[model samples]
Structures are given as structure tokens and as C-alpha cells.
Target chain A: MYTRQNQKNLTSAQRKRFVAAVLELKRNGTYDEFVRTHDRYFVPDDEDGLRVGHMSPSFFPWHRRYLLDFERALRDLDPTVSVPYWDWTTDRSPASSLWGEDFMGGTGRGPDRKVDTGPFAHDRGNWEITVGVTEARYLTRNLGRPHKPITLPTAEELKWAIDEPAYDVSPWDSRASGSFRNKLEGWARNGAERWSNHNKVHQWIGGHMTGGTAPNDPVFWLHHAFVDLIWDRWQARHPGSGYLPAAPLDRWDRQRGRVLTRDDPMPPWNVTPAQLMSHKGIYRYEV
Target chain B: MRPYPTRCNPRTAAAVLTRRAVLRTVFTAGVVSATAAALAPVFRSRRTVAPAATPGPRPAPLFEETYRGRHISAAPAADGSRGGLDVRIDGRPLHVMRRADGSYLSGVNHFESFDSPLDLARAAVDELGSVRLAAAPAHHG
Candidate 1:
């Protein structure tokens, strides 16, 4: 299986190939379609369009399948390209080399905060946004301008989240108070500090990365890859912990008539959480 | 037929028979009138109306309207409670719910809390922006 490597660890050649393959996807219109699909789900007006991939236990599986699809698309163009994971906790600043012209690109500029340098820059004409815009057409990033000083979770904080006894707690959602998933997802906060993790990173990135179609930014892959890596780590730590709300357990069908169960097929994909619990046949992350 | 009251001739008997026929006709006419009055409303209503029209879909709100021009802020609370900070958007509580685990959840999206109100508000703005143009008529081109 192709291994997903830390973005900071990628060799110069590997980084170049990854960048080129992403450009190729954008050039072919496949990338924008992915962005559009994600946008549709997150902001669906109908009951069927609730954010199933988010605010629920399906978060991990949905994103895992989604990332796999994207990776496969990239590999189709360049067999060597694999999506890289960005350990934001290690970098923690806008000045990271990952934002240089050679890699993903730098922070955005004024007026609209659109990036002026890098492969995905509007000047390059390859990363134009085909979806999720009403007036402006370029990708944007304010990069900590619109929020507090950007910071990533510390090792201790991550350990605290991973050490929980259960994968999820009652409610099993963003509102779940005692859930490791909620804590890691950045919704569960300690005391009154507010939840701060995945959500914080997205806000820290700013611009298009903050939006539902954040995948429009190539960094979106790196960010999510790392998130998946954390989930993998959590699974390893709690070997006995399986997905919550097991089958035969009834959860009212807010979207449809059927009650939700672990075995129930996740919409927009044919897979279930049980199927995605392990990375066995799919791919592995390079530690 | 009784042959009694022979003195009572055929003329009086015929008159009595005519009176009984007139009374029967009046009673039959009254019944018909009463039945028409009772049934008139149902037929009249049916003729004038059709089955209720199915409600058209309700339109989604505009992105700008979600907050109602309210600014979101997250800052340390003055009360000095253990909660650290208060998050408010549009001058209303935003990420105010404290879970049993001590993590904060936003009432806005019921998602994770932000490190600051600014962070939380930014997420809310991004979420609101995700609304498709068809749903957000004001933003439509």
C-alpha cells in the first residue's frame, strides 16, 4: 500500500510530484467537483443533507473514504504521488516552509486575502475556484488575521484526549461531553476554554481552509491526513473500543424512516464505520 | 261505508277527504325544504373549493442573516468562573454550553468550541457561507 508521509518529511522530488498531480486534478475539473460535493453536504437545506460527516460518529469513516477517493484520483495522474499529512502541532506557525512557493504556497494577501505565490496561486491560473463562491473567484487565506494567535494542541493535550476510556460518550456527537472523539474533533473543551483542536486548526489556517469546501486548498489534505493519523492512533490505544451505537440499537431516523446503527450504510458512500475501522487494505501512514 | 250517519251525505265526506290531501301536501313540502337547507352548505362548499395545496418548500436564510449583524466575541469572563471565557455572537450566547467532560459546545452548530470567540465566529461565518445560492436568494447572481 502507498504510504502517507508527513509533509515536512517529504523529499523535494516527492513534494514536487504531489504538487503537480494536484494541479493536474484541478486542471481536469475533478478537484472542484470534490469541493462542490463537500459543500453540498455540509450546507444541505433539506433534512437529508445534515452534516453526517461531521458532528457525528461517522466523521472518521466519512473523511477516511473521502480522502481515499482523493488520493486515488491523484495517483491516477502520477503513480508516485500520495497525500501527505501535516502535523500542525509541530509547525504551529504561518511561516512554515510548507507554505513556500515550492510546496503548497504561502498565506494570502489583502483585498480578498488570496494567495499570491505557489503552485495553487491565482496567478498560476490552475487553482481557480469553480465552486462555493458567489462573487469572488480566487482561493483565499487570511492566516491568523481573522482569529486569535494561531496555535496547535500540545502533546500533553493530545494524550489527554487519547487516554479516555471510551471512543464516544452519551449523545455521541459534537455535543458529547465525555467523548474522546469530540475532544479530538475539537468540540469538547476543558472547563470554559471552549473546544480547541481540529476546529482551531481550521480557523488558524483561515481563508478557504476555514470553509466547508476547505479541501479546495491542497493543505486541506495534509490537515485531514493528520487528523486521520490521530484517529488511527486512538484506535490502536483502545483496541477493544468499536464504533458506538451498534446495530439493533435504535436511533430515530432524523433523515429517513430507519434508525441509525453502526452497520447502517453511511450515505454518499457504500461503506460503514465497521468497514473503515482499520486501514488494512486501504493504505497506511508512514510514522 | 258504515251506512251510519246516512244523514251525512257524500258531499261532506268528499270535503273531508280533500282537506286531508291538502295537509299531506304541505307536510311533504316542509320536509323537502328542510332537507335542502341542511344539504345546501355541503354541496356549495364542495363546488367552490379544491383540496388543500401542498406547502411549497421554505427558503433557507441568507448567510448574513444567520447572525443578524451580530458580532461574535470570545473573551475571559469578568465573573472569574472556572469556565475561563464567555463566547457571544450578535450579543447573544454562542458557545455557552459546558459539557459534563468540561468541554464547551457551541449552540450555533453544536460542534466543538473555539479557543476564542473570534475563532468560533469565524467558523460560524464559514458555515453560513456554505449555503448554496439557490437557498440564499439574497446572494443569488
Candidate 2:
């Protein structure tokens, strides 16, 4: 078993080892593969088509497995290294420790919005964006989206989502309302604030973080780790409640071939959301 | 942001639609006719010259416009792939995909799908701010 600590609490040495492992993954081309994989699986839900990653009930499980694969890759380099979580609810500033030059680095600056400080900065020659939507080689970020003035997810906003009882509801997509999965996944269609939680944080970061190739920014793992922790907390709070859509939808149903049931196998590893229901002995979040 | 979640609200959407309809009619006549349109509104009305059919909302021009000082357009991809559209902003290619839900998403702002490719392209421009989108690599697996 391993512990995923809060990123703010990580010591300088622990941060060093984690950064080293990620840079190694980038050097060996494994990092780019993760970027490509996320871009590939970020399928949006539509009529009669399968979607396991985003916009579905499996968004949590699929990403949980994806993070496990990534953490395992990091452990291959150093057994002590575990992915840390960035609780955006608290660490909501550009000046926060999360963006310090010693670790994940600061916001992208200048006309190009390029990250020029910290280890992952482009000029350092250690990190280059190979698998990207655009030809830009540098990793970029616009923390707080200066001109837009967007804020991070608030603690109150998070409480509102975790309070939800059902794992998911009908249609099992982004538009699905009143589901814990949809709420935490952060697709708010009712008000002027369209993106609230997870999606909003992505927007707050801007640049490559806004798109499919977001993993190019090393913080992707930490951001996801925190999101994964929320699932753990949700599970503990609602032990009686479990994953919804327990059985596959009827064959005639439009969502039959599209949404993954509790037992349906998620691709890349063929593990079902049922199997990934709980982390348990595998790992635990350090709360 | 105007055409986003605010557009999702039925009440606000109606307001936007009402304003949009007026702008659509005024902008539809042509740039040269903008001044004379108010004076000769009846001549500018399509119903006066043509039939009453085709009286619904005029479709938005999907291509060739400057968005936030950035020139953006969408065209059928050269490869002829299904739902494949070659979108660009400021002369650089902006990758786009068609969702089964009939919305369009782009390389930037991939999470939030837009109602049309034009909206998707504009979102990318907004996300970029001052930084320009570089030419994407020829292939992405």
C-alpha cells in the first residue's frame, strides 16, 4: 500500500524524487504516450456510440485506472514516489506552493504564454511537448486566466456535489443532472458559470491544460489524484450507495452500446468500473 | 461566454435570441445596405421580394470572419474523413471534431463542446488570448 499525500505537504526531497520520475517518463517517451492516450479516449457522448472516458459514468473509474498506470510507471523509476493530490478548493492562488519554481512551476508568461520558470519550463531542455494538438514545443499555462479572472473551485461548491446520493442517473452523460458523477465532473448547464469544479479548474489553468493533451503538464496527475481522492471520500460517506446502472441497458436502448455498466470492461486495461470500485489495499489517500 | 451556459438558460436564451434576430435581420441585408436598410426596410425584407417560405432565422455564416482580431474559418478537411473539418484561426490550423451529439469540439477547449464549429473555433481564440496557435504536427495517433 502507498499514500497519496497532499501536494502542499510534500517535503523538498519527496518533491525532487517525484519530479525526477516524471522527467524520466518524458525522456523515455512514455509521457507522450499518456498524452496520446488521453486525447484518444476523451470521447464525447452522442447517439449509440461508446464513450468510457469523459462525459460518462465511467469518467471516475477510467481516470482512476489511468492514474494507477501512471503511478506505476513512476514507481518503476522509484518505489517511494506516489502521485500527490492538489486540492484546488484550498490551493487557489497563483502564488500557492503548487506553482513554486521548485516543483510544478509557475504560470506561463509573455506573448506566447510559455512557462519559463521551474523544472518543467521549456528552456530547461528536460521537458518538450511532443504529443500536442499544436506544433508548440513548450509547455504552457495561464494560471487564473488573467484576463478572464476565473477562480478555483470553492470548498462549498465541492460539498454541494459530494452531498449527491446517486452515483449516476439516466443518459449517464455530461448533461445528466443530479448525479454525483456529473456534479463532480463539473458540467453546469444551468447558470452563466458553465464549468464549475473539475472542468473549471482546467479553464483556470488555461493553455495546454484546457485541451485534450493536458497531460503534457505534469500537474495533470496531481490534479487528477485530488479528484480521485474525492471519489474515495464519496464512497466512504455513502457506503450503502454504489455504482449505478448496475446492469447493462437493454439492447434496444440507445445507451446500450454507448455507456458502460458497472461490469463493462474499460479499454486500455479491460478492467471494469466494478473492479475499480474501491482502491482499498492497493492505495489510499492521505487525508 | 454569451453563447455558452447563459444560452442554456431558456429565459436568457430567449433574450439573446430576440436580440440576435434583430441583429441578424439588420446584418443580413449587406454591409452596403446598413444605412439605407432603416429608410427602406420594406425593400430589404426578403418577404417583400421573395416568398414567405424561408422566413425562419437566417443561418449564421460558419466561415470567414474575424474573431477577437483573429481570422478564423472552417472548411471540409482535405482528407475527406467523415465529420472531418479543417478549422483555422489566424491562418494556422485549428483541429476540430464532430461529436455524435451534433456539437463541435476543438484541440483547445476540448472538454466543452460547442453548438457549431464556429463557436468551437472562437472558444479556441479566446483561450489563446495573445499567444498564437502554432501549426499542429502533421499526424496525431
Could you say which candidate leads in lDDT? Answer: 2
Tell me how each candidate scores on DockQ against the true complex.
Answer: 0.03, 0.18
TM-score of each: 0.68, 0.82
Interface RMSD, model 2, angstroms:
12.4
lDDT by residue for model 1 (B18-131), tens: 754664565567766555455444433322232232255422211222343445555444332213344444444432333323334333333344443355565555543332
| RMSD after CA superposition, every candidate | 22.1, 11.5
CAPRI-style class, candidate 1: incorrect
For model 1, residues A193-272, the per-residue Cα lDDT tens digits are: 56567777776766666555577788988988998999989888989887775745322223222223468787688677
Docking class of 2: incorrect
lDDT of 1: 0.62
Residue ranges of candidate 2 with Cα displaced over 4 Å: A190-192, B1-61, B75-86, B98-103, B130-141
Q: What tens digits encode model 2's per-residue C-alpha lDDT throughout A1-287? A: 99999999999999999999999999999988999999888766642346888888998999999999999999999999999999999998999998988899999886577899999999999998877766568988989887668899899888878888898998788778888998888874425667678888888898899988899999999999998999988888889889978997854344666788999888979999999998999898887
lDDT of 2 by residue, B21-134 (tens): 766686585645445335343322321121122234542334779988889987544442323455778888876655544577677886677887778888888788766776
Q: Against the true structure, candidate 2 has what lDDT? A: 0.78
